[model samples]
Target: MAFEGLASKLQETIKKLKGKGKLSEKDIKEAMREVKLALLEADVNFKVVKNFVKDVSEKCLGNEVLESLTPGQQVIKIVNDELTKLMGESESKLELNSNGISVIMLVGLQGAGKTTMAGKLALKLRKDNKKPLLVACDVYRPAAIKQLQVVGKSIDIPVFTMGDQTSPVDIAKASIEHAKSIGCNVVIVDTAGRLHIDEELMDELKDIKEYVNPNEILLVVDSMTGQDAVNVAESFNSKLELSGVILTKLDGDTRGGAALSIRAMTEKPIKFVGMGEKMSDLETFYPERMASRILGMGDVLSLIEKAQEAIDEEKAQELGNRMLNQEFNFEDFLSMLEQMKNLGPLGKILEMMPGANAKELKDLDLSQGEKEMSKIESIIHSMTLEERRKPSIIIASPSRKKRIANGSGTSIQEVNKILKHYELMKKTMKNMKGMQKGMQKKMKKGLFGKLPF
Candidate 1:
């Protein structure tokens, strides 16, 4: 969703190149021109866009690409490579101090989701087996300390806070000793931010930096701010010598600017990205994987990782066996829906699919799909246990359908649609089971020589 417009345009431009069996210099020039426009329209910094286009165009014009068996694919690969390089070329992990507590100072302008990011990062570190302490250092904003406390409490992390009367520099310094006493291996200082970059803000941040000597000075930036985000990063880097950046609000209607421009502009790798408002939505930023997604090449690795984290392997296997054995029912279907919800939104899953057309996905009303899923869940929940296990009974009785419709607050026709869909799914599983049995019989007869009889 962040790069919807740019991805659509880039995919369309590449599609034309893919259709051409051979490419001429003129063809590549035209494609590059289109790409240049797309990036600019995406609000990518002008200098970054220029350098990206120049590099891609030169690579595409190379003889290796021009004479390749599949010139179109070669060109796409070159674009992908350039895109990755533009976004820091690799993942930049947090440089924690192995010997003692790692201090990370988070700095950003106001309204960049800094407080929430602190909780997310601490939670992530805790999952990695580190005891993390969150320090509330934002003494200026109203309720800033309270916000940090609430966030830390929700995540079950300790939040070290002095009152708003204390200077942030002093609060940050005190948090370290507090962390040491509690055996926290990592201390994340949530610093204050101003409406804009100012000397007072920088001086205060500098004071905290001087006091803490943090292992990381990560600048939290709102990715939706486009070039302004880049400018903020540049200013902060100039003052603080930042270790990395954490982009927030990337799930919003972002134009793909900050993510593409920050690293090229500031020479800092993006450490993490805030994908949603949920505490668990912070994801490690992988340049190669992001490039693949931008090129319509699907981030299968991230998708699989998400599945492994969210889906229970035992439950998934049981569900799979039930489906293959043609025993899937409304109960199983409900379980499947709950599992799917854990994988995140359907639109995001679609975005990770290989060759998914951004325009086509945009045309789909994903919110409506979410509502339909809720409706289906409601309809299923309204059914009796017997009806759930044996949907055939509901199918045969109109009165049963009427009862379910009334319980779910829907029309009978809607209830009927759900029943029909369930029947179709069961029929499909039955047919697949038959095909599998047939294949197994043939395999035993031919490959195993009648099982050594």
Candidate 2:
């Protein structure tokens, strides 16, 4: 969503060459020119775009176009392939040792969401059955430790801290021992942050790292700082010898330069992304999925990955079939709604879409959404079991809407709108399901399917 305008422009510009029988050097040059302009307009690094365009032009011209492949198609493929590789060839993951408690040190500037990320990663690892101990190593600020404790408790994990007097290095060392005693398989040290990079801050972080000998050192950077973030990441990676990075504030209206530039500059695979303020907002980094999003094609891979990570796999598979059959009910609807919350806030999801602009979606904050969604959950909670399972009957009862509106502190119109939207979505799903089934039948008859050769 960060580069929506740029994505739309590039997609439209490339569509002109999609079905061409042949492409002259002039045509290729024109397309690259437009692409370079689009990237710069998106606030991407100017140098990066120049290099990207030059590389793409050389790769496409050097490639021998197959007789069956149009020159335009061949050029597009080369660009896509190179774009994917520029980000990284595959998904990057955090490495954890099963032999003992793996310690992870989190470092970054103030307001970069370093503490919040520590809790999010702890929760994510805990969900994977790894016992995680949250270390409150950011002791310079009085509330920093409290923040980690609060996040840890919300996710039912334990926080390791020793009031404010102890040095962070001491606290980190003690936390490792505490982790071993508590059977926690991982210890996450949430380190202190500064408003800007300074010698003292670097020395403080380095001291803690030396004292604890962490398995991984993650540099968290705010994506909204544009080129500054890439520079900050490079500096930290150079001084600390970081294992990887965590790009925070991705759900913000970022300029797209930082995310695109950091990877190229550091050559370090981004391990995770912090999309929102919630404890469950961290996600593994995937280059192919991000490339698709940047291209404005809709990132179905990341969407499905989020769903798979949050929902019960077997239950989700069953719900998938029911959606195809038009048999999905309010029960399934409630589950789906809850599932969205588990992935993170609704507004954050929209902001991450390749076509959604951060500025346009700035008002869609996660804190505001929590209150609104709680009200909806309360309304749903007030319903009787039978009423929830048979929502059509409840909507038909004129008095029920008024009762729910009052009970949930909402309006009658709100309830009606929700019901209407649900019905329309179900209808669309059924039609798509029918169309897919018909295509499958044709394919099985040997009269369909694209020829591989």
Candidate 3:
């Protein structure tokens, strides 16, 4: 959803180009002109847009692209390449010391989500077998230290707080000794953020940097702030010599101007992006995959990674085996829904899919879908164990169906529909398995023999 507006506009422009069998110089120029306007309308920096359009236009005009049979496709590729290059071409890994503990200082303006990001990063590092210590250096903001401690507790990570009385510089220096005592391989200092950039704030941040000499100085910027986020990154980079940047609120940034322009403007790689408020929502910034998504191409790699993280492989394989044997029941259905919930919102998951137009799904009531899922879950939960294992009993007994409907607070028609759908799913899975095994006999037997439908 981050780049929905920009993606829709760019995809529309590319759609027209793809429709063409051949392209003329004038046609390419016209398309580039539209692309330029699209970028500008997305709130991308004027200078960045100007340079991007110029670079894309020059590449489109080259004979390598123009002389091709599919010139339009070639031109789109050039745009994708330029977009990837605009953001850093590859992932900017955090600078971690192999032999010693790594200290990372998070700096940003207030409301940029520095504290939350510290927890997110710690959660990620913990997954990599690193003992991460979250240091609370945000003494200015009310209850900032308490906020950090709360975040650390939720994730089961250690928090090193010196309270609000100690200076941040002193706190930062002391946190290292704390991390060493606790055997923490990584220390993430959640520094204070101001309402706006000021000399006092910069000096305090500089003081922490001088005291700790952190391996990575990450600037957290809110992507929804547009060019203001870029300016903030530039300012921070000038003073801190930032190792990288982290774009927060990216999921809500429909225009995505900051994501598109910050790295190019500040000459700092965007190390990560906060996709949502959940601690697991923080993701490493991948420019090529982002460009692919912007161009209406799905990010299959990220989709797969989400699946790997959310789904249990053993359970998945066992479920598949049971489905193939026509043993899938309401229990398995409930388990599948639980796994899907862990994958995040359905709308967000759909966005990562190829050809899933974010604009088209913009009007979809996700909460309504969630409510429906809850209703279905309640209906299933109301069923007896035997009824859940063998839905055929419910199909034969109207009284039982009515009892379940009453129990789930629904009508008998809805209960019957669930049974019918369950049978359909069972038959469908058998057919799919039979096809996978290249056995027509199994498919034929499963298709028309015992199924009530």
The lDDT per prediction is 0.92, 0.77, 0.89
Best by lDDT: 1
Clashing pairs in 2: 1-353, 253-358
Candidate number that wins on lDDT, 2 or 3: 3
**If ranked by lDDT, best first, what sequence of candidates would result?**
1, 3, 2
- Candidate 2 matches the true fold with a TM-score of 0.78
Q: What would the per-residue lDDT of candidate 2 be over residues 1-453, giving only the tens digit for each residue?
A: 455566566666667777678766777788889988877776667778888899988876664743336776676567777677777768877777969879999988887888888889988897788889999988787699899888888888899999888888899999988988988889998988874458888888888888888889998897778778877888888788988888887766445667777777788878888776677777788777776665544576677677678778888889898887878777787787787677665654664565653334544566676786676677777677887777787778879988887877888887787778768978999889889988899887675456564
lDDT tens digits by residue: candidate 1, 253-305: 44799999999999999999999888999999999999998889999999999
The deviation in Å at residue 145 for candidate 2 is 1.0
User: What's the lDDT of the predicted structure labeled candidate 1?
Assistant: 0.92
Residue-level lDDT tens digits of model 3 in 24-78: 8998889989998889988999999999999998889899887889877897789
Query: What C-alpha lDDT, on a 0 to 100 scale, does residue 349 get in candidate 2?
Result: 64
**Clashes per model (N, Cα, C within 3 A):** 0, 2, 0
Candidate 2's C-alpha lDDT? 0.77
Rate residue 172 of model 1 by lDDT.
Answer: 92
What TM-score would every model get versus the actual structure?
A: 0.92, 0.78, 0.92
Q: Which 10-residue span in candidate 2 carries the lowest summed lDDT?
A: 356-365
Residue 136 displacement in candidate 1 (angstroms): 1.0
